[model samples]
Target chain A: AQSVTQPDIHITVSEGASLELRCNYSYGATPYLFWYVQSPGQGLQLLLKYFSGDTLVQGIKGFEAEFKRSQSSFNLRKPSVHWSDAAEYFCAVVASGTASKLTFGTGTRLQVTL
Target chain B: DTAVSQTPKYLVTQMGNDKSIKCEQNLGHDTMYWYKQDSKKFLKIMFSYNNKELIINETVPNRFSPKSPDKAHLNLHINSLELGDSAVYFCASSPFDRNTEAFFGQGTRLTVV
Candidate 1:
């Protein structure tokens, strides 16, 4: 079974400061990785996805993620975060064969300070 | 227009009552799914349908039933809802291709009191 682990339960960052949310996955084969953001009372929105090639994947709202095979990790990064970026972030994984079945982590709540 | 939409964004009902959440996708995707987000913000797939055919049914309780009348619509019906069932339910759709990403709806927050 494929599982995603987001070790940070919550993170607080000052506005305009750099941010990184760590995500680790355990899968037997190559995994399809994704990052999703959910605002308060809103549904999850796809930030970006990693299918193949180009380990460095860019996403919406000036966000990006790097997939490191050796570390079994796909961490989301931003050079600077805005107050609106504060939300619950989830790291998800899709097994090689099962595309529709997305296994998500417990999620990381991001709080941006002004 | 919303790519994926679910009816009754907020549903508050008493325990032991039955309710249904309807989902429709305008993206014309072939696969649709229902996902549950618990209070702790853990998301898990509950059911999936491909071309109106049941494809994946996770270890969810039988009280939770999903119906797909067509490829573009998927509805979830819960029977005798329990307090534990209070969570946000999301509907999503995606192409049949393995590399495609799923588009999610606004979600239906079901509260059982």
Candidate 2:
């Protein structure tokens, strides 16, 4: 079974400050990774995804994530976050051969302080 | 136009009542899924259907039934709802390929009192 672990339950970053959300996954082989954001009372939106080829994947709203095979991590990063970036971010993984099943981590609540 | 849409954005009902939530996707994706998001912001997959065929069924209660009449529609029906069943349900669809990303609906919030 593939599982995602987000160590930080809550993260607070000031506006214009850089941010990084850690995500670790447990999977036997190379897996498909994704980052999703959910604003309050809204559904989850795809931030980015990593399947093959490039180790660094860029997403909407100037967000990006790098897939590290050695560490089994796909951490989301943004150079400068805005106040509207505050939301719940989830890290998800789909094991090889399981295209429809997505295992998500307990979301990390981002708080952008001005 | 909404690529994925779920009816009754907000549903409030008492315990022991039966209710249903309908979902439709116009993306023409072959796979559709039902995901539950708890109050604590944890998401879990409940059911998935591909081309009107059931593919993934999680460890959900038997009271929760999902029906896919066609490739573009997947409806979830809950029987004898409990307080524990109160949560936000999201409908999502994606292409059959592994590299594709799933598009999610706004979600339907269900409250059982």
Candidate 3:
């Protein structure tokens, strides 16, 4: 079945440290990958999405993700982590069709330390 | 603002009860969706409606019903809710198809005790 996997369940990074959250997906066609950030007591916000064109896509809040077709991976990265950036990150993929229903990963929680 | 919005940000109810969550989007979107965020904060699409028609329905229980009166409105009605139903229900909207970035609402935290 089609699915999205975020191998890292939980990650911790210092306020100024670089951060990376990895994601892999299983799909048959050209997948439409997306990264979403969920702050505490809030809804999921779109960080970035990859539909076509360049493999590296830039997103809001100084975040970016690269979609690698060979690896079937779309990893989210940040140059410097902030205390406020500590939140749950999810990677999702839309099925190939008009439905385009999104399949989300279990999620990866990032903890920012001092 | 041209954004998706949901009402009753917080709901606290008991099991075996019935409740409804309402959603609205003024983004001139043609599709509206209902998603559930579990306790562990995993978001999944529950249902989708396009042009007031049900397009995609996941393997959700029949107790949970979604009604789209119009293109801009879709409401979820849950009957005889169970303890496992306790989670955050989110409402989102997209302009046309699956490739579009969906706009989300603040979410309705439904608590079943």
Complex DockQ, candidate 3: 0.72
Candidate 2 wrong stretches, greater than 4 Å:
none
Query: Once superposed on the true structure, which residue ranges of model 1 sit more than 4 Å away at CA?
Result: none
Better of 2 and 3 by lDDT: 2
Between which residue pairs do clashes occur in model 2?
A: none
Better of 2 and 3 by TM-score: 2
Error of 1 at B82 (Å): 1.0
**In order, what DockQ does each candidate have?**
0.78, 0.79, 0.72
How high is the lDDT of residue A32 in model 1?
Answer: 89
All candidates' chain B TM-scores are 0.99, 0.99, 0.96
Per-residue lDDT of model 3, residues A1-114, tens digit only? 689999999999999999999999999989999998989888889999999999999999999999999999999999999899999999999887686578899999999999
Cα lDDT, all candidates? 0.95, 0.94, 0.92
List clashing residue pairs in candidate 1: none
Encode model 2's per-residue lDDT on B6-109: one tens digit a residue: 99899999999999999999999999999999889899999999999888888899999999999999999999999999999999999987878889999999
TM-score of chain A for the candidates in order shown: 0.97, 0.97, 0.97
How do all models score by TM-score? 0.98, 0.98, 0.97
1 versus 2: better lDDT goes to: 1
